[model samples]
Target: MSRTTALDPLFTAVDTAAFTDRHLANLAAGTLAAVRVPDFLGNAACRAALSALDRLPTTDYDPGRVPTPIVRFGPALNDYRDQDGHLDAERYWRDAEAARVAWHRAALRPDPIAVSMGHLSAAWGAALAPATINGRAVFGGTLREINAGALIHYDDINREYPTGLFDQEVIAQLAFNVWVAVPPTGGATTVWRHRWEPADDHHRQAYGYRSETVEHCQHVTLTPKLGDGLLFNPANFHAVEPNPDGRRIAFAFFLGLTTTGQLITWS
Candidate 1:
């Protein structure tokens, strides 16, 4: 008999067909991979979508006033801030629908975001067939640009999650991003295979869990190409490197399964 050592899932590829739903869920729980779906939408569609973002009205800094121009693309999610100077939910969704339509028209194909999300969900369900994946897995999250970089941090470490959230199954969950625009330089996402736990209370603060909290952890970096899609366990420590040459724009979301056999997607 052979034994399998528990290890993090790490994939680097141009296709994801080989991975099963269990694989993806397991990846979310304890794996990492960067898959490049070949011609998934192609660079042309990405360019079109990127250009279209400018046409849509953008909201000013978020509630805490982050000073970033954020567009809540697609339908709004719970707890989404009605930020000052930002487009309200109605306006935002209306524009998002318009943008998605225009981008698909320009792509001369189906809306990649829509199509991608559908495929992803279906695959996940199939991966857990007979379980009847039941839960709200809708789209709509922050779409924004960054000129510089982001400091090292772990996402969702301090989130006061609502009751019955699917991602609660595990202390970890997966994150998704479809890059519509990439800077000429310095736009890599840096991630440390580390996570937040009570052990790091000494350095943990309200603002964030600084990188130094787990200074000795090994790390990895990933840079997205135009039209590229990525998935990772965001609960682990991660950060975005600055892009000095140009702005980096992307659509982001969160994904996970529930202990009750429901796989969900949200932003």
Candidate 2:
């Protein structure tokens, strides 16, 4: 893997106390690699969210498709995608509603997802709404426990549903994750400066591409910390390093900046 002589200016991570309009704009415009907010949730809030996790029903992703054992407590749209890359709306909606009910029953105080969204909306200076299909709002926010790590991959709703998925025209998509618990070591996420291209398919493996896909691209790696929030462009290739120690639990969702300049969310 040959490395670039100097890192690209737009491939830098911005660490701040809170998510600012500038940071969000720069990220969406591909002028920034990522935005990290330390202590996005308070210690007490993190503890509360973590405590509620035990009571929530968690399930592993399909072992056949995902060799890694990722425990999660919400519906991910990709899981409902059919062979033709189309959404299985019926099953997705059912599971999404069930997950919502289970989340409420967990009785997590100061709901971390809602709190995170509130802060994001404040930064955007407008309310962030859930992206809807037709008139029905899609589910937002999921609790994922990734201790074994995830595969190298990129997520773009536009590419996932080429014909279009939501009623709003999403011009850009950002991934948001707030950690309630993190391992003592490892569990770092690495985002490469590369995006998908036709030639990259030769390295495709399982649900993601091989590491060689972005071997020569500039990248940024972020270690997860409790109460930390991260936002990054998901169109860039990224992967998570396995954590051999404690649990890595996070509340996550995707934010889509529509053509109309509204930030909509979905999981």
Candidate 3:
């Protein structure tokens, strides 16, 4: 699809005014919903970016342990090995962050048309107005070149978005992610479910949330196409399945409001 045609479905699905109203309502009720902005980047831009990415270095993954459960493949590294094979996670993350900053500066110039913040407030009202939802200070802004893969387990403890070490709350407030799908080759960024058995009878379960049977695991295959992009709640229980064929690129940011207000964070 042409760049012009790619943006049609996204604009059609979201009506700015109506979305704002619903956002306010959801904020009042304290219910979370995933908001998807499909085909965010136009076809022409996506093609150009993918071509550029092909010439760039491939992302590397860390072999050591990390706090999160998801796997990551990016140019950034969490640690590096010296001649003696020693590793330092802090230095690795710093170097990666620095490289990311430089790359972003170069990519955002000359032709800066990759991501959009159109549905930020409407889809992520609470993230935008944290003061209303919780009595605390909130911050909002954007970060560039930091790509990540995350997995949110329902049973994990101390997984607060805004306050933990990672500051998920801040991340959400920024509305950091932008997505693009390229050509006949389906890129990485697939979401999947791990094979697991049903919990014991004593384990309690909540509605809309159930354990999956080991033998009945489900996998949703997302193919990269001319007019396909997905935006959803970042805090939702999901995973960024790797791109198997071509390269699939997405951008992410954070959005925040005061404690008394609502915050809105979406893809």
Candidate 4:
């Protein structure tokens, strides 16, 4: 992974109390903003999706082998990076059949789960009208959750571009997840006012980055309710708190924003 020295301008002058289009500009500078939209995903649709997901098969993704069921998607990713960024394709496509079926089942339904992930990515990109990538989204991510909770980390990926898109065309990627199921306790996402610049290189390793790098930075942790859709730049340092006694499930995907503002996505 590499860091870009050029910093985008942050629009601190704009009012962020509401999540308006203005946040798009702020997002370019790596700012975190959220707005509570009423019925972000129709209540009935959101509930149905959650219920349906519970019945589907899930593959464990935790390195410690916790019972966290996850289905990671994208055009084509190799293998998970080892403890030192080394490639290992051993677990590649282990449960491909089951994952694809589950994804498509919800995608083609009358009241689909937040639309096709690709469609949802495009709709959001079009709404943002990013400078380069316009409505062209890649599809793949995961129904993200953790057994107890996830460790503090940034969701940025450094994968080889076998999907035909080079990294140079994109400036940053955004993350959007619909809150369909949440716990009665902790499951908040905390976005730190920090990006993974080269200075934070020491935190890089397999099993994910450490939280100490941005410990002193300011942060805003969000606990979204059912049907709440959240959009923010995933390039910033962020983390998720634990929900030991409950489940926190979301359809998580990444939105690739090109330097010219085109929108593309993959999980």
Best by TM-score: 2
Ranking by lDDT: 2, 1, 4, 3
Error of 1 at 74 (Å): 6.4
Residue-pair clashes per prediction, in order, are: 5, 0, 52, 19
Tens-digit lDDT string for candidate 3 (195-261): 1224522332321123332113322334434434333332233344333344345544333432435
Candidate 1 vs candidate 2: which has greater TM-score?
Answer: 2
C-alpha root-mean-square deviation, each candidate: 7.4, 1.3, 11.5, 6.5
Tens digit of lDDT per residue, candidate 2, span 1-267? 466646787689888999987888888999999999999999999999988888789999889899999999889887888989899999999999998899889988989999999999999999999999999999999999999999999999999999899999999999999999999999999999989999999999889999888888889999988899999999999999999999999999999999999999999
Among these predictions, the greatest lDDT belongs to 2
- Which portions of model 4 miss their true places by more than 4 Å? 1-21, 32-38, 62-98, 106-138, 158-168, 199-206
What TM-score does prediction 1 earn? Answer: 0.68
lDDT of each: 0.56, 0.93, 0.35, 0.55
For candidate 1, give the lDDT.
Answer: 0.56
For 173-203, candidate 4 gives per-residue lDDT tens digits of: 6677777677888888777667667777788
Between candidates 2 and 3, the one scoring higher on TM-score is: 2
Better of 3 and 4 by lDDT: 4
- Runs in model 2 with CA error above 4 Å? 1-6
TM-score of 4: 0.70
State the lDDT of candidate 1 residue by residue for 96-143, as single tens digits: 566456544554233455656665666676432111113322334446
Model 4, CA-based lDDT: 0.55
TM-score of each: 0.68, 0.97, 0.46, 0.70
lDDT of 3: 0.35
Model 2: which residue pairs collide?
none
